[model samples]
Target: MKTKIFGHRGSAGTHPENTMISFKEAARVGADGIELDIQMTKDGVIVVIHDETVKRTTNGKDKGWVKDYTLKQLKKMDASYKFKDQYGICEIPTLEEVFDWAKSNQLLINVEFKTGLVAYKGIEEKTLKMINDYGLEDRIVLSSFNHYSLVKCRQLSSTIDLAILYMEGLYEPWDYAKRLHTNGIHPYHQTINKEIVDESIRNGIAVRPFTINDEKKMKEFIDYGCSAIITDHPKMAAALIK
Candidate 1:
Protein backbone atom coordinates (compact mmCIF):
# COMPACT_ATOMS: atom_id res chain seq x y z
CA MET A 1 0.00 0.00 0.00
CA LYS A 2 1.14 3.57 -0.65
CA THR A 3 2.32 5.34 2.48
CA LYS A 4 0.16 8.14 3.87
CA ILE A 5 1.30 11.59 5.02
CA PHE A 6 -0.14 13.30 8.07
CA GLY A 7 0.47 16.99 8.73
CA HIS A 8 2.24 17.48 12.03
CA ARG A 9 0.42 20.07 14.09
CA GLY A 10 -1.13 21.07 10.77
CA SER A 11 1.83 22.32 8.77
CA ALA A 12 3.58 23.69 11.82
CA GLY A 13 6.59 24.80 9.81
CA THR A 14 4.47 27.40 8.00
CA HIS A 15 1.50 28.16 10.24
CA PRO A 16 1.13 28.45 13.98
CA GLU A 17 0.97 24.93 15.34
CA ASN A 18 -2.47 23.59 16.32
CA THR A 19 -4.35 26.65 15.16
CA MET A 20 -7.35 26.41 12.80
CA ILE A 21 -5.50 28.24 10.01
CA SER A 22 -2.71 25.70 10.25
CA PHE A 23 -5.13 22.81 9.91
CA LYS A 24 -6.83 24.44 6.93
CA GLU A 25 -3.46 24.89 5.25
CA ALA A 26 -2.72 21.19 5.72
CA ALA A 27 -5.95 20.22 3.97
CA ARG A 28 -5.28 22.72 1.19
CA VAL A 29 -1.88 21.12 0.60
CA GLY A 30 -3.53 17.71 0.04
CA ALA A 31 -2.51 16.06 3.29
CA ASP A 32 -4.28 12.76 3.90
CA GLY A 33 -4.52 13.42 7.64
CA ILE A 34 -3.73 15.98 10.31
CA GLU A 35 -2.31 15.19 13.74
CA LEU A 36 -3.08 17.45 16.72
CA ASP A 37 -2.73 17.55 20.51
CA ILE A 38 -5.66 18.14 22.81
CA GLN A 39 -5.74 19.46 26.37
CA MET A 40 -8.74 20.02 28.59
CA THR A 41 -9.69 23.51 29.74
CA LYS A 42 -10.78 24.35 33.28
CA ASP A 43 -14.42 23.76 32.39
CA GLY A 44 -13.62 20.29 30.94
CA VAL A 45 -13.74 21.43 27.31
CA ILE A 46 -11.19 19.86 24.97
CA VAL A 47 -9.05 22.41 23.13
CA VAL A 48 -6.40 21.96 20.44
CA ILE A 49 -2.92 22.92 21.70
CA HIS A 50 0.51 21.37 22.09
CA ASP A 51 1.88 22.86 25.30
CA GLU A 52 0.36 22.39 28.75
CA THR A 53 1.09 26.07 29.37
CA VAL A 54 -0.20 28.95 27.24
CA LYS A 55 3.04 30.89 27.50
CA ARG A 56 4.69 29.12 24.61
CA THR A 57 2.01 29.63 21.93
CA THR A 58 -0.33 32.35 23.05
CA ASN A 59 -0.41 36.08 23.81
CA GLY A 60 -2.56 35.69 26.89
CA LYS A 61 -1.87 38.21 29.63
CA ASP A 62 -1.69 35.51 32.29
CA LYS A 63 0.21 32.82 30.32
CA GLY A 64 -0.81 30.24 32.87
CA TRP A 65 -1.52 26.51 32.78
CA VAL A 66 -4.18 25.50 30.26
CA LYS A 67 -6.20 23.68 32.90
CA ASP A 68 -6.50 26.83 34.92
CA TYR A 69 -8.47 28.76 32.29
CA THR A 70 -12.05 28.40 31.16
CA LEU A 71 -12.87 28.12 27.47
CA LYS A 72 -13.95 31.75 27.27
CA GLN A 73 -10.77 32.98 28.92
CA LEU A 74 -8.62 30.77 26.68
CA LYS A 75 -10.29 32.06 23.49
CA LYS A 76 -9.45 35.65 24.29
CA MET A 77 -5.73 34.94 23.92
CA ASP A 78 -4.05 35.04 20.50
CA ALA A 79 -2.86 31.54 19.63
CA SER A 80 -1.04 32.89 16.59
CA TYR A 81 1.07 35.29 18.56
CA LYS A 82 4.21 34.37 16.68
CA PHE A 83 2.51 35.12 13.38
CA LYS A 84 0.38 37.99 14.63
CA ASP A 85 1.91 40.40 12.11
CA GLN A 86 0.84 38.07 9.29
CA TYR A 87 -2.38 36.40 10.49
CA GLY A 88 -3.64 38.84 13.10
CA ILE A 89 -5.30 37.06 16.08
CA CYS A 90 -6.20 33.40 16.09
CA GLU A 91 -8.31 31.94 18.82
CA ILE A 92 -7.54 28.58 20.31
CA PRO A 93 -10.06 26.19 18.74
CA THR A 94 -12.27 23.80 20.65
CA LEU A 95 -12.32 20.15 19.63
CA GLU A 96 -15.99 20.55 18.71
CA GLU A 97 -15.16 23.43 16.37
CA VAL A 98 -12.51 21.28 14.71
CA PHE A 99 -14.91 18.36 14.44
CA ASP A 100 -17.49 20.59 12.84
CA TRP A 101 -14.91 21.81 10.34
CA ALA A 102 -13.52 18.28 9.74
CA LYS A 103 -16.95 16.93 8.86
CA SER A 104 -16.79 18.82 5.58
CA ASN A 105 -13.50 17.23 4.53
CA GLN A 106 -11.99 13.72 4.22
CA LEU A 107 -8.88 14.38 6.33
CA LEU A 108 -8.17 11.83 9.05
CA ILE A 109 -7.77 13.24 12.56
CA ASN A 110 -5.14 11.87 14.94
CA VAL A 111 -5.99 13.21 18.38
CA GLU A 112 -3.16 12.91 20.90
CA PHE A 113 -4.41 13.16 24.45
CA LYS A 114 -2.09 15.35 26.57
CA THR A 115 -2.75 13.33 29.68
CA GLY A 116 0.76 12.15 30.40
CA LEU A 117 1.49 15.35 32.29
CA VAL A 118 -1.90 16.19 33.82
CA ALA A 119 -4.53 13.53 33.99
CA TYR A 120 -7.65 15.34 32.85
CA LYS A 121 -10.31 13.31 34.55
CA GLY A 122 -12.91 11.98 32.07
CA ILE A 123 -11.03 13.33 29.04
CA GLU A 124 -11.11 9.94 27.37
CA GLU A 125 -14.87 9.57 27.73
CA LYS A 126 -15.52 13.15 26.70
CA THR A 127 -13.41 12.89 23.56
CA LEU A 128 -14.87 9.53 22.63
CA LYS A 129 -18.41 10.76 23.04
CA MET A 130 -17.68 13.77 20.83
CA ILE A 131 -16.13 11.57 18.12
CA ASN A 132 -19.13 9.26 18.23
CA ASP A 133 -21.52 12.17 18.21
CA TYR A 134 -19.84 13.45 15.07
CA GLY A 135 -19.79 9.96 13.50
CA LEU A 136 -16.03 10.16 13.04
CA GLU A 137 -14.77 7.04 14.79
CA ASP A 138 -13.51 5.55 11.53
CA ARG A 139 -11.48 8.65 10.69
CA ILE A 140 -10.09 9.33 14.18
CA VAL A 141 -6.97 7.80 15.71
CA LEU A 142 -6.51 8.26 19.44
CA SER A 143 -2.91 8.09 20.67
CA SER A 144 -0.95 9.03 23.78
CA PHE A 145 2.36 8.57 25.63
CA ASN A 146 0.37 7.37 28.62
CA HIS A 147 -0.25 3.67 28.06
CA TYR A 148 -2.65 3.57 31.01
CA SER A 149 -4.82 6.17 29.31
CA LEU A 150 -4.70 4.13 26.11
CA VAL A 151 -5.83 1.11 28.14
CA LYS A 152 -8.70 3.09 29.58
CA CYS A 153 -9.66 4.12 26.03
CA ARG A 154 -9.49 0.46 24.97
CA GLN A 155 -11.83 -0.53 27.80
CA LEU A 156 -14.23 2.17 26.70
CA SER A 157 -14.25 1.42 22.96
CA SER A 158 -12.88 -1.59 21.16
CA THR A 159 -13.36 -0.41 17.57
CA ILE A 160 -11.77 3.03 17.36
CA ASP A 161 -8.10 3.01 16.40
CA LEU A 162 -5.47 3.56 19.15
CA ALA A 163 -1.73 4.04 18.66
CA ILE A 164 1.04 4.16 21.23
CA LEU A 165 3.28 7.26 21.11
CA TYR A 166 6.85 6.66 22.26
CA MET A 167 10.17 8.38 21.79
CA GLU A 168 12.38 5.44 22.80
CA GLY A 169 13.07 2.11 21.18
CA LEU A 170 11.19 -0.82 22.63
CA TYR A 171 11.87 -4.49 21.94
CA GLU A 172 9.16 -5.93 19.69
CA PRO A 173 6.91 -2.98 20.19
CA TRP A 174 4.28 -4.61 18.00
CA ASP A 175 3.95 -7.43 20.51
CA TYR A 176 3.80 -4.88 23.32
CA ALA A 177 1.07 -3.02 21.40
CA LYS A 178 -0.86 -6.23 20.91
CA ARG A 179 -0.83 -6.78 24.65
CA LEU A 180 -2.19 -3.28 25.11
CA HIS A 181 -4.92 -3.96 22.50
CA THR A 182 -3.60 -1.21 20.22
CA ASN A 183 -3.08 -1.71 16.49
CA GLY A 184 -0.62 1.07 15.69
CA ILE A 185 2.62 2.65 16.90
CA HIS A 186 3.85 6.25 16.47
CA PRO A 187 7.54 6.19 17.21
CA TYR A 188 10.10 8.93 17.07
CA HIS A 189 11.58 9.12 13.55
CA GLN A 190 15.11 8.18 14.70
CA THR A 191 13.97 5.22 16.81
CA ILE A 192 12.81 3.11 13.83
CA ASN A 193 14.50 1.40 10.90
CA LYS A 194 13.56 -0.98 8.09
CA GLU A 195 13.73 -4.06 10.32
CA ILE A 196 11.33 -2.68 12.93
CA VAL A 197 8.87 -1.49 10.30
CA ASP A 198 8.91 -4.90 8.65
CA GLU A 199 8.46 -6.66 11.99
CA SER A 200 5.63 -4.42 13.02
CA ILE A 201 3.84 -4.89 9.71
CA ARG A 202 4.32 -8.64 9.93
CA ASN A 203 2.45 -8.64 13.23
CA GLY A 204 -0.49 -6.62 11.84
CA ILE A 205 0.73 -3.44 13.52
CA ALA A 206 1.02 -0.18 11.62
CA VAL A 207 4.11 1.98 12.15
CA ARG A 208 3.98 5.74 11.60
CA PRO A 209 6.93 7.83 12.64
CA PHE A 210 6.62 11.47 13.74
CA THR A 211 8.09 14.96 13.08
CA ILE A 212 10.09 13.99 9.98
CA ASN A 213 10.77 17.36 8.34
CA ASP A 214 13.83 16.55 6.28
CA GLU A 215 13.35 15.63 2.60
CA LYS A 216 15.82 12.73 2.72
CA LYS A 217 14.24 11.09 5.78
CA MET A 218 10.75 11.57 4.38
CA LYS A 219 11.71 9.79 1.17
CA GLU A 220 13.55 7.07 3.10
CA PHE A 221 10.60 6.22 5.37
CA ILE A 222 8.11 6.33 2.49
CA ASP A 223 10.36 3.98 0.53
CA TYR A 224 10.41 1.71 3.58
CA GLY A 225 6.62 1.37 3.22
CA CYS A 226 5.68 2.91 6.54
CA SER A 227 1.94 3.07 7.11
CA ALA A 228 2.24 6.86 7.49
CA ILE A 229 4.59 9.70 8.39
CA ILE A 230 3.92 12.78 10.49
CA THR A 231 5.72 15.84 9.13
CA ASP A 232 5.72 19.58 9.62
CA HIS A 233 5.84 20.04 5.84
CA PRO A 234 3.03 18.01 4.30
CA LYS A 235 3.40 19.77 0.96
CA MET A 236 6.96 18.56 0.62
CA ALA A 237 6.04 15.00 1.60
CA ALA A 238 3.09 14.99 -0.79
CA ALA A 239 5.30 16.10 -3.66
CA LEU A 240 7.83 13.39 -2.88
CA ILE A 241 5.11 10.73 -2.69
CA LYS A 242 3.71 11.77 -6.05
Candidate 2:
Protein backbone atom coordinates (compact mmCIF):
# COMPACT_ATOMS: atom_id res chain seq x y z
CA MET A 1 0.00 0.00 0.00
CA LYS A 2 1.09 3.59 -0.55
CA THR A 3 2.17 5.57 2.48
CA LYS A 4 -0.52 7.80 3.95
CA ILE A 5 -0.12 11.50 4.77
CA PHE A 6 -1.74 12.78 7.96
CA GLY A 7 -1.69 16.53 8.56
CA HIS A 8 0.11 17.19 11.81
CA ARG A 9 -2.08 19.62 13.70
CA GLY A 10 -3.89 20.11 10.43
CA SER A 11 -1.50 21.86 7.99
CA ALA A 12 0.17 23.67 10.87
CA GLY A 13 2.92 24.98 8.60
CA THR A 14 0.52 27.46 7.01
CA HIS A 15 -2.37 27.75 9.45
CA PRO A 16 -3.21 27.83 13.12
CA GLU A 17 -2.56 24.39 14.60
CA ASN A 18 -5.65 22.44 15.69
CA THR A 19 -8.14 25.03 14.52
CA MET A 20 -10.98 24.26 12.12
CA ILE A 21 -9.38 26.34 9.40
CA SER A 22 -6.32 24.13 9.33
CA PHE A 23 -8.41 20.95 9.23
CA LYS A 24 -10.38 22.20 6.28
CA GLU A 25 -7.22 23.22 4.49
CA ALA A 26 -5.72 19.77 5.06
CA ALA A 27 -8.76 18.17 3.44
CA ARG A 28 -8.74 20.74 0.65
CA VAL A 29 -5.10 19.94 -0.07
CA GLY A 30 -5.77 16.17 -0.20
CA ALA A 31 -4.43 14.90 3.07
CA ASP A 32 -5.41 11.30 3.77
CA GLY A 33 -5.88 12.07 7.46
CA ILE A 34 -5.39 14.62 10.25
CA GLU A 35 -3.55 14.31 13.57
CA LEU A 36 -4.75 16.48 16.47
CA ASP A 37 -4.27 16.75 20.19
CA ILE A 38 -7.07 16.67 22.77
CA GLN A 39 -7.32 17.90 26.33
CA MET A 40 -10.10 18.33 28.87
CA THR A 41 -11.24 21.79 29.83
CA LYS A 42 -12.19 22.74 33.38
CA ASP A 43 -15.76 21.89 32.52
CA GLY A 44 -14.68 18.44 31.39
CA VAL A 45 -15.16 19.26 27.73
CA ILE A 46 -12.80 17.66 25.24
CA VAL A 47 -11.11 20.44 23.32
CA VAL A 48 -8.89 20.10 20.26
CA ILE A 49 -5.50 21.75 20.90
CA HIS A 50 -1.86 20.68 21.06
CA ASP A 51 -0.38 22.48 24.02
CA GLU A 52 -1.26 22.47 27.70
CA THR A 53 -1.09 26.26 27.50
CA VAL A 54 -3.29 28.42 25.29
CA LYS A 55 -0.60 31.11 24.99
CA ARG A 56 1.20 29.63 22.03
CA THR A 57 -1.83 29.23 19.76
CA THR A 58 -4.24 31.79 21.11
CA ASN A 59 -3.99 35.54 21.62
CA GLY A 60 -4.20 35.18 25.40
CA LYS A 61 -1.59 37.32 27.11
CA ASP A 62 -1.15 35.43 30.38
CA LYS A 63 -0.65 31.95 28.87
CA GLY A 64 -3.68 30.20 30.29
CA TRP A 65 -3.70 26.46 30.88
CA VAL A 66 -6.45 24.57 29.12
CA LYS A 67 -7.29 22.83 32.39
CA ASP A 68 -7.90 26.16 34.13
CA TYR A 69 -10.64 27.33 31.81
CA THR A 70 -14.12 26.21 30.87
CA LEU A 71 -15.15 25.46 27.31
CA LYS A 72 -16.91 28.81 27.08
CA GLN A 73 -13.80 30.63 28.22
CA LEU A 74 -11.61 28.70 25.82
CA LYS A 75 -13.91 29.35 22.89
CA LYS A 76 -13.68 33.09 23.50
CA MET A 77 -9.93 33.14 22.92
CA ASP A 78 -8.76 33.97 19.40
CA ALA A 79 -6.69 30.99 18.32
CA SER A 80 -5.58 32.29 14.91
CA TYR A 81 -4.28 35.76 15.75
CA LYS A 82 -0.65 34.68 15.73
CA PHE A 83 -0.95 33.14 12.27
CA LYS A 84 -1.11 34.86 8.90
CA ASP A 85 -4.30 36.93 8.50
CA GLN A 86 -5.65 34.75 5.73
CA TYR A 87 -6.56 32.14 8.31
CA GLY A 88 -9.12 34.56 9.83
CA ILE A 89 -10.44 34.25 13.36
CA CYS A 90 -10.32 30.74 14.82
CA GLU A 91 -11.62 29.30 18.03
CA ILE A 92 -10.63 26.24 19.99
CA PRO A 93 -13.01 23.58 18.76
CA THR A 94 -14.63 21.04 20.97
CA LEU A 95 -14.01 17.42 20.03
CA GLU A 96 -17.72 17.08 19.20
CA GLU A 97 -17.41 19.79 16.60
CA VAL A 98 -14.55 17.93 14.98
CA PHE A 99 -16.55 14.69 15.01
CA ASP A 100 -19.50 16.39 13.38
CA TRP A 101 -17.22 17.76 10.67
CA ALA A 102 -15.47 14.41 10.22
CA LYS A 103 -18.66 12.35 9.94
CA SER A 104 -19.29 13.67 6.47
CA ASN A 105 -15.72 13.10 5.28
CA GLN A 106 -13.48 10.08 4.66
CA LEU A 107 -10.47 11.45 6.50
CA LEU A 108 -8.86 9.37 9.19
CA ILE A 109 -8.63 11.15 12.58
CA ASN A 110 -5.67 10.49 14.82
CA VAL A 111 -6.68 11.83 18.26
CA GLU A 112 -3.73 12.15 20.59
CA PHE A 113 -4.63 12.45 24.24
CA LYS A 114 -2.66 15.29 25.86
CA THR A 115 -2.34 13.18 29.00
CA GLY A 116 1.43 12.95 29.12
CA LEU A 117 1.53 16.42 30.57
CA VAL A 118 -1.79 16.75 32.42
CA ALA A 119 -3.69 13.63 33.30
CA TYR A 120 -7.28 14.75 33.36
CA LYS A 121 -9.40 12.34 35.32
CA GLY A 122 -11.94 10.39 33.29
CA ILE A 123 -10.53 11.68 30.02
CA GLU A 124 -10.29 8.15 28.64
CA GLU A 125 -13.89 7.31 29.42
CA LYS A 126 -15.09 10.64 28.11
CA THR A 127 -13.14 10.33 24.86
CA LEU A 128 -14.22 6.74 24.23
CA LYS A 129 -17.85 7.56 24.86
CA MET A 130 -17.71 10.60 22.59
CA ILE A 131 -16.09 8.64 19.78
CA ASN A 132 -18.75 5.97 20.05
CA ASP A 133 -21.51 8.57 20.20
CA TYR A 134 -20.20 10.06 16.98
CA GLY A 135 -20.01 6.60 15.40
CA LEU A 136 -16.34 7.20 14.62
CA GLU A 137 -14.92 4.11 16.29
CA ASP A 138 -13.53 2.66 13.08
CA ARG A 139 -12.32 5.92 11.58
CA ILE A 140 -10.50 7.18 14.67
CA VAL A 141 -7.22 6.09 16.22
CA LEU A 142 -6.33 7.09 19.80
CA SER A 143 -2.68 7.80 20.50
CA SER A 144 -0.76 9.02 23.56
CA PHE A 145 2.70 9.00 25.07
CA ASN A 146 1.04 7.82 28.27
CA HIS A 147 0.86 4.06 27.79
CA TYR A 148 -1.25 3.63 30.91
CA SER A 149 -3.94 5.91 29.52
CA LEU A 150 -4.02 3.80 26.36
CA VAL A 151 -4.42 0.69 28.50
CA LYS A 152 -7.29 2.40 30.25
CA CYS A 153 -8.85 3.14 26.89
CA ARG A 154 -8.64 -0.55 25.96
CA GLN A 155 -10.28 -1.40 29.22
CA LEU A 156 -13.27 0.61 28.05
CA SER A 157 -13.41 -0.59 24.42
CA SER A 158 -11.68 -3.55 22.84
CA THR A 159 -12.17 -2.42 19.28
CA ILE A 160 -10.86 1.16 19.47
CA ASP A 161 -7.59 1.23 17.52
CA LEU A 162 -4.79 2.53 19.72
CA ALA A 163 -1.20 3.64 19.09
CA ILE A 164 1.70 4.33 21.44
CA LEU A 165 3.65 7.53 20.82
CA TYR A 166 7.26 7.84 21.91
CA MET A 167 10.14 10.17 21.19
CA GLU A 168 13.02 7.81 21.96
CA GLY A 169 14.20 4.45 20.65
CA LEU A 170 12.51 1.34 21.90
CA TYR A 171 13.91 -2.16 22.25
CA GLU A 172 10.99 -3.62 20.31
CA PRO A 173 8.13 -1.18 20.00
CA TRP A 174 5.97 -3.68 18.18
CA ASP A 175 6.23 -6.07 21.11
CA TYR A 176 5.32 -3.32 23.52
CA ALA A 177 2.33 -2.42 21.39
CA LYS A 178 1.28 -6.07 21.33
CA ARG A 179 1.42 -6.19 25.08
CA LEU A 180 -0.72 -3.07 25.25
CA HIS A 181 -3.06 -4.62 22.68
CA THR A 182 -2.59 -1.55 20.50
CA ASN A 183 -2.69 -1.67 16.71
CA GLY A 184 0.13 0.78 15.96
CA ILE A 185 3.22 2.68 17.10
CA HIS A 186 3.92 6.41 16.61
CA PRO A 187 7.58 7.23 16.84
CA TYR A 188 9.24 10.61 16.50
CA HIS A 189 10.19 11.02 12.82
CA GLN A 190 13.88 11.23 13.59
CA THR A 191 13.78 7.98 15.57
CA ILE A 192 12.52 5.85 12.68
CA ASN A 193 14.82 3.81 10.42
CA LYS A 194 14.41 1.12 7.79
CA GLU A 195 14.85 -1.69 10.31
CA ILE A 196 12.17 -0.32 12.60
CA VAL A 197 9.75 0.20 9.76
CA ASP A 198 10.40 -3.30 8.37
CA GLU A 199 9.91 -4.90 11.77
CA SER A 200 6.65 -3.04 12.32
CA ILE A 201 5.37 -4.11 8.90
CA ARG A 202 6.38 -7.73 9.48
CA ASN A 203 4.59 -7.69 12.80
CA GLY A 204 1.44 -6.35 11.19
CA ILE A 205 1.55 -3.18 13.23
CA ALA A 206 1.20 0.26 11.68
CA VAL A 207 4.23 2.52 12.01
CA ARG A 208 3.40 6.24 11.92
CA PRO A 209 6.06 8.84 12.57
CA PHE A 210 5.19 12.42 13.59
CA THR A 211 5.98 16.03 12.60
CA ILE A 212 7.89 15.24 9.42
CA ASN A 213 8.23 18.55 7.46
CA ASP A 214 11.20 18.23 5.10
CA GLU A 215 10.55 16.90 1.57
CA LYS A 216 13.61 14.67 1.44
CA LYS A 217 12.84 13.23 4.87
CA MET A 218 9.24 12.56 3.91
CA LYS A 219 10.42 10.63 0.84
CA GLU A 220 12.93 8.71 2.96
CA PHE A 221 10.17 7.50 5.31
CA ILE A 222 7.97 6.64 2.34
CA ASP A 223 10.82 4.59 0.88
CA TYR A 224 11.16 2.88 4.26
CA GLY A 225 7.52 1.92 3.80
CA CYS A 226 6.03 3.77 6.71
CA SER A 227 2.33 3.16 7.14
CA ALA A 228 1.78 6.90 7.56
CA ILE A 229 3.50 10.19 8.31
CA ILE A 230 2.14 13.02 10.48
CA THR A 231 3.50 16.26 9.06
CA ASP A 232 2.97 19.99 9.35
CA HIS A 233 3.22 20.14 5.56
CA PRO A 234 0.69 17.55 4.50
CA LYS A 235 0.13 19.28 1.17
CA MET A 236 3.80 19.04 0.35
CA ALA A 237 3.96 15.44 1.47
CA ALA A 238 0.90 14.56 -0.60
CA ALA A 239 2.52 16.17 -3.62
CA LEU A 240 5.72 14.19 -3.07
CA ILE A 241 3.84 10.89 -2.80
CA LYS A 242 2.12 11.60 -6.09
Best by TM-score: 1
lDDT of 2: 0.92
130-207 per-residue lDDT for model 2 (tens digits): 888888898899999999999999999999999999999898889999999999999998787899899988998999
In angstroms, what RMSD does candidate 2 have relative to the true structure? 1.0
- Poorest lDDT segment (10 consecutive residues) of candidate 2: 80-89
- Model 1, span 1-242: residue lDDT tens: 99999999998988988999999999999899999999999999999999999999998787799999999999889999578888888889999999999989999999999998999999999999999999999999999999998999999999989999999989899999999999899999899899999999999999999989999999999989999999999999999999
Tell me the whole-model lDDT of each prediction, alpha carbons only: 0.94, 0.92
TM-score of 2: 0.97
> Which regions of candidate 1 fall more than 4 Å away from where they truly are?
none
Q: Judging by lDDT against the true structure, name the best candidate.
A: 1
Against the correct fold, how does model 1 do in TM-score?
0.99
